[model samples]
Target: MATVELRFSAQPEHVRTARLVAAAVARRAGVDEAVLDEVRLAVGEACSRAVGLHRSHGIDAPVHVVLTEEEKLFSIEVGDEVPGSGGGASAVPGVRASGADDGDDGAEDEMGLAVISGLVDDVEVTSGESGGVIRMSWPTTPATVLP
Candidate 1:
């Protein structure tokens, strides 16, 4: 598998860059042309969610975006440094971030994930003491970018 990793401060403005990079990489990875818009929207939702979580919780660590190109799949993972509930409550769909106390933001966060869910067919969300990641994957067209 080939991978591209990006780190950015928890800022709203940075989200657009992440979305653009994700789309370019996904295009090179052979994600269907028609689905490029979905990829961009999904990445934006994921990154925006991460940024909000970081800022609300006073976490200084950067947001993480990992794009991986595999034999037949392209997957993007967006992660946040916000701590999770020791029990992983955030793992539940539409639930609040594990340890998040931003009441209204929690609702917005859930809505963001919902949007991402609608855009990407394959998605995995996980959280723990370390952080949370939203992993979205799509099928490729057998055209992988060369080094």
Candidate 2:
């Protein structure tokens, strides 16, 4: 197994960098060529979600993106440092019951989650006081033996 870890300030612009890195790593890990765009989009959404949570909650902790490559799988984990972000409503961290506090609707968060679910076949979302993590994985093609 191999891993690549990245931490960046809670800034929206940095999400693009995370997505690019994820796609590059996924490609090298033998993820299907057609799935590269899905990986990029899912990573972008997850990173953006983390960045938004950090900003909204006044938490300066950097967003975390961990990419792991195993024999037949490639996984990426996006985490945020927002307290109580995962206690309830949705699987995603920022999600809340419709029309919750912060004077902001949770629709965007839900939409982001929906997009991620649509893109990734294997996904796990969890949160607690410590923070939250969205782990998404894709199957990797096995290396063919050349005679």
**Tens-digit lDDT track of model 2 for 82-125:** 76564323544544433347747666666777899998889998
Give the residue spans of candidate 1 off by over 4 A.
85-106, 144-147
TM-score for every candidate vs. truth? 0.82, 0.84
Candidate 1 has an lDDT of 0.81
For all candidates in order, the CA lDDT equals 0.81, 0.83
lDDT of candidate 1 over 1-147, digit per residue (tens): 447899999988999999999999999889999999999999998888788777766788899999999888999988887667222335434445434566655566667778887878899888777988888899999865679
Which stretches of model 2 miss by more than 4 angstroms? 87-106, 144-147
